[model samples]
Target: MTTPYLLILLVIGLGAGVSSGIFGIGGGILIVPALMYWAKFSQHAAVGTSLAILLPPVGLAAVTEYYRSGNVDLKVAGIVAAGVLVGGWLGASIANQLNGHTLKLVFGLFVLLMGAYLTASAARAI
Candidate 1:
């Protein structure tokens, strides 16, 4: 990779790490999209790479801190993690079979729907 690409990856990694730490969100949410947009990675490649990076304890320290602060829900997190493992595999498999444009469109729609749901839920909570 070129120096510029390396720099981009470093910046993307830092952003993803910080976002994951602060929001307790999987890095895939931001990382995949950023990689697609900034790094010009295909959706499947971005998702696959994100999964590879996340397979390790990338956020273990942050998660442990949250647990120590009594902010981590182990039971819920375990269940969700289990579901994500299954769902992510299925999603990635399907995405790999799709064309890049189709994958981008589907990913965009999914993000839009998720954003809408989060907005509604936040409003309701308020």
Candidate 2:
């Protein structure tokens, strides 16, 4: 890849990595938006690329830190991962059937709701 493209990827990975480690999210939260806006990818392309990163990342950074702090429950996590695998397949199957506009609308609404909930919860704690 070209230097500029590489740099964009580096920034995206950095953002995704930090956000993943901190907030238990990376691809959907950071990478998707970064890919869509900065990389000028279509929403479907962004989603596909973000999904591709899931297995490769292996949750190493966040998992290691959580493991060190004794916050990990490996058995439980493994079980959850299994569920996520199944759910991802199911979700993709459904998502593929939807038109771009409808998919974007639903995805946006979900993000907005989550953002609002998180904001409200944080405010309550402050």
Q: Rate the local accuracy (lDDT) of all candidates.
A: 0.83, 0.87
Candidate 2 lDDT over residue span 10-126, tens digit each = 999998888888878888878988888898887788888899986677577678888999999999999999999899999989888888778778888989999999999999999
lDDT of 2: 0.87
Show pairs that collide, candidate 2: none
User: What CA RMSD would you report for each candidate?
Assistant: 2.1, 1.4
Q: Among all windows of ten consecutive residues in candidate 2, which has the lowest summed lDDT?
A: 53-62
Q: What is the lDDT of residue 46 in candidate 2?
A: 84
Best by lDDT: 2
Taking all chains together, each candidate's TM-score versus the true structure is 0.82, 0.90
Full-model lDDT, candidate 1: 0.83
Task: Score candidate 2 by TM-score against the native.
Answer: 0.90
RMSD value for candidate 2:
1.4
In model 1, where is the ten-residue run with the lowest total lDDT?
Answer: 53-62
